[model samples]
Target: MGADERERLFQRARECSGHRRTWSEADRLWTQVIDAYRQAVSGSGRVDPNDRRQLARALWRHGMLLAARGRPAEGLATGREAVTIFEQLNDAAARDATDQGRDEALAELITAVLDLAETAFAAGEPVLRMDLLDRAVAAGLRTAGPPPSAGPRTREAMGTAYHNQATALLHRCLTGTSPDEDAREAALAASRACELRQRLMDPLRPLSVWEMANTYGLYAQCLTLIRDLDRAATVLDLGNRLVELLGPAGAQPALKLRVAATMLARERASARGGTGQRRWGWRRH
Candidate 1:
C-alpha cells in the first residue's frame, strides 16, 4: 500500500484505541499499522522522517494501551523505543535550521518522553522516570519559550511536564533516599508548575481552576517538607481560595489543600516544641 493507505490504517487504529471497549481491535489494527510502515521502509531501502514519526506515534499509543491492559513491561519497552525514535527526529530537526520543524519535533519528543516516563514510573523505575521527566522539562521549556510568547498547546504541555516533574520529585522526597535534595527540587518544580498553570487559568474553565489548585497544594507540600511553614501556609491559602472559587468541582484539590495545611501545622508545631493549632482557618460555607 501507499503512504495514504498507511495513514488511513493509523487513523483507524487511533479511533479504535480511543475507547476501552475497542482496545482489542485497536491492538490488532496497531499491529497492522506498524507492519505496514516497516514494510514500506524495507521496500524503499531508505528511512523517511515522516514514516518514522508515524511509527513512533503508533508505538507510543500502543504502549499506553498495553499498559492499560495490564502488560506494563511490554508497554515500557515499546515506550522506550518510541522515545528513542522521537529523540532522533528531534535531533535531526534541530540540525536542519527550520524553526517550524524543530519546534514540532521537539513537541513530539517531549510528549513521547513524558509518556515513557510515566510508563517507567509504573514499571517501578523511579530514577529512570525522573531522568525522563527532566528531559521532558528541558524540551518543554525550549518549545514553550517565554510564557508571553507561548501558544496554548505549548503552554499546556509545559505546565503538564512541570506538574509531573514536581509530583515525581515530591514522591521521591517522601519515599526515596534523598529527602532534602528531592524536597528542594520538588519545590522548584512545583513552583514552575504553579506559574504556568496560573497563566493558563480561566474562571470559565473549572478544570483549569482545579489544576491550578492542585499545583498550589503540591507547592505547599514541598514548602512544608522543607519546613518553610510561612510560605507553605501562603500556598495552601491560595489553593483554598481557588477551591472556594471553584465550588463543588474543586473538592479534590480542597482535600489536597487541607492535607497540606495539616502537614504545615504539624511542621510548625515541631519547630516550636508544641502542638500547633489549626491556625490556617478553612472557612465553611
Candidate 2:
C-alpha cells in the first residue's frame, strides 16, 4: 500500500480504538496497518525512519487495546516491540550531527517506555515495570533539560514518570520484602514529582491542581514511610489545602489526605516513644 493508504488505515484504526464498541475492528485495522508497513519495508529492502515511527505507533495503540480487552500478556509483548522501536529511533536521533528531532524522539521514547511499564505492571511483572519506569524518568529528564527551560509537554511527562515511579515503589514496599530501601527511593521519586508539578501548577486548571494535590498525598505517604513525621504532616497539610481548593470534587483525595494525616500523627506519637505502635504502619490504599 502507499504511504497515504497506510496513514488512512492508521487513522481509521485510531478512531475505532477510541471507542469501546469498535475495539475489535480497531484491532483488525491495526494489524492491516502493520502488515502494510512490513510489506513496504520488505519491498524496499530498508526501513524508512518515518515508517518505523508509524509502525511503532500502531504497535503501541494495538498493545494498549489488547490490554484493555483483557489480554495483558499479549499486550505486554506488543508494547515491548513498540518501546524497542522507539528506543532505536531515539538512539539514531541522538547520533544525528544536525541535532534534528532529538527532543521529539526522546519525548516519544519516554511515552512508549512509560506505556510499556504500565503494561508490565498490569502483567504482574514489577521488576520490568520498575526498570521501564526508570528508563522513562531518565528519558524525561533528557527531554526536560534544566529547570524553567523545559517545554510544558516535557515537564508534564517528567512529572508523570516521577509520580508513577514513586507510586510503584511504594506499592512494592508495602507488598514486597524490602520496605526501608524502597521507601527511601520512593521518597526521592515523589520529591521530584512534586517539584515538577509545582512548576506546572496553575489555579485556572483544576486538573493540574488535582494532580498536585494527589502528588502531595503520595509524597506525604513516602515521608511517613521514612519516619519523617514532621515533613509528612506539613506535606499533608499542603495536600489538604489543595483539596479544599477543589470543593466537593476533592472528596476522595480529601479522605486520603485525612488518612495520611492520621498516619502522620500516629508516627509522631510513636516517635515520642509511644508503646505497641508499629513504625511505618500506614494502611495501603
Candidate 3:
C-alpha cells in the first residue's frame, strides 16, 4: 500500500481503538512510511520534488528514531539521504518546492542537519554533530529570513529546528562520559533553546496552553538534566499552569504526558536533597 493508504489505515486503527489506548497501528504505518521513503530515494528520479521533501522529512525523523532504538548505522545513512533532498529543495527558488520555499527549504535543511547531528551523536561522533549543527544554523539564516508571525510556516520550522539542535546538544552532554566543560556547554546550549522558544511563544500573542507548556516543559527537563532542579521545578509549574488555557484548542497527549512527567520529576528531585531550600536556591544561589 501507499504511504497515504498506510496512514489512513493507521488513523482508522487509532479511531477504532479510541485515541487514548495504545495501538501499534500507527507505529506500523510510520515504519512503512519510512521504508517507502528509503525505497523512493533509491529511485528518486520518479518522485516529485515536493513529495521528495515531505518523504525526506519522514525518513529523517524515522531514521533518527530507529537509531535511538539501536539501528544507528541504518538510521544515520537514512538521515544522510534525507539531507541531500533537503539541500535540493533549499536551493530551489519556487513555491512548488516550499510553502515558503526559500525559507522552507532552509528549514528542511536545518531539520535534516539536526537529524544528521542526532544520528551522528547516537553513533558516537560529537565532532560530526557539532559540524552538522553549525551548517544547520548557517543554512537556517539564509532560508529563515524573518521572525515568526502567526501561521507563518517558516517561523515555526525555524523554532522547531532551534529546539531540535538544542535538544541534541543536551543529549550529547548528558550522555557523555566527559569532562565538566562539555556538560557546561550543553547546559548553555539548552538555555539558548529555552530563550528562543520563549520568544517564539510570545509573538503569537495569547499563546496556546499546549505551546507554552511544551516550551516550558522542555526547558524544565533540560534544566533538570543539567542538575538545575530548582529552575526546572519553576518552569514545570509554568507549563502546568498553561494547560487550563490550552484546553479549548485541544492539546497533544504526548506533550501533556511530558508535562506530567516533568512535574513528577521535579517533586522527586526536590525530595532527594535539602528539599525545601533547593526548591528556591538555583536562582538565588
Q: What is the C-alpha lDDT of each candidate?
A: 0.83, 0.85, 0.60
RMSD of model 1, in Å?
A: 4.7
Looking at model 2, the pairs that clash are none
- Candidate with better lDDT, 2 vs 3: 2
User: In candidate 1, which residue ranges exceed 4 Å CA deviation?
Assistant: 45-48, 97-100, 140-155, 203-207, 244-252, 269-285
Winning candidate number (TM-score): 2
RMSD of each: 4.7, 3.1, 7.5
Indicate the worst ten consecutive residues by lDDT in candidate 2.
276-285
- The best candidate by lDDT is 2
Q: Which lDDT tens digits does candidate 3 get at residues 88-130?
A: 7767644444355565566567767877887887888877878
lDDT of 2: 0.85
Reference-based lDDT, residue 21, model 2? 98
Per-residue lDDT of 143-194 in model 1, one digit per residue for the tens?
Answer: 5566456556556777878888989988877677878898899998888889
TM-score of every prediction relative to native: 0.81, 0.84, 0.56
Model 1 lowest lDDT segment of ten: 276-285
